[model samples]
Target: MRFYPATLSRLLAVAALAFSPLSWAEQAISDGVYEIHYNAFNSSFITPEVAQQNGLMRSKYRALVNVSVLKLQDDGSKQAVTAIVSGQAANLIGQAQQLEFKKIDEGKALYYIGGFRFTEDEQLKISLSVQPDPNKPAYNIEFDQRFYVD
Candidate 1:
């Protein structure tokens, strides 16, 4: 998991000791210079303290989306960079909900997270727009995710 924030690991954890299918599945994308990593999972797995401190909704029906941007340097090292990330999630039935992102800043490391509601066994199509830098073109990515409520 390529998380920028120090407390992100504590926030995004698998429900069980094993790697369940519904675990945090982080994915990455790049346009040569910029790398964007993102993932979405049920918010209930996060501890109450972590959730409260981060203003995350910790309910079975709530889900959170995490996104981080990195810039590739000439030395082949990735540097965390701030970016504007916004998106929306739409269910299979075409019900769309806008995602309001909250920036979590941790010194040099920072990331954007958004929360949305989901139903049991609900599958949603997530669409995101990432702009790591104004000089570069904006990145758009989409994926489908299924959420289960315990």
Candidate 2:
């Protein structure tokens, strides 16, 4: 069987894509802090009509935040932290801090986390602790919103 140069190139490209790191989801975690996992998607939220109506003369930007805490080890130790998944959307520019948390309906001590329109270049601070009972620590998480313009 003889393969043309174009056919061989196509096969190589497919193999490269299959083995590329970009083809897999990326996950990163900051020890004793939080974990984030995400995959790039199509960026097509900006429309000419929206730019004209909303007075946005530049390209639009969007990002997803998936953060959470793993376990609760000790008193004053932040744990069980999770990012609030809200439907709130905002421009990557400007100043805004929108975050909310609620107790989880299931599990021994679980909670639901969510946030909206977080626009900042500072690291978000999440503090968890047990007030009266050091054994039962709560979670408080902060998210530093960062943006990358192209």
Candidate 2 is scored at a TM of 0.27
lDDT of each model, Cα atoms only?
0.79, 0.32
For residue 10, what is the lDDT in candidate 2? 39
Q: What ranges in model 1 sit over 4 Å off? A: 1-5, 13-26
Residues 65-148, model 1: lDDT tens digits? 888888999999988899988999999989999999999877766678898999989889999999987777679989888888
Residue 126's lDDT in candidate 1: 92
Error of 2 at 148 (Å): 17
Q: What's the TM-score of every candidate structure?
A: 0.85, 0.27
Across 1-150, the per-residue lDDT of candidate 2 in tens digits comes to: 443334422332342234323434333344443433222211123234422432323332332222233444556454443443332233434334443433332233233333332223322232222122334443333322234332
Compared with the true structure, the alpha-carbon lDDT of candidate 1 equals: 0.79
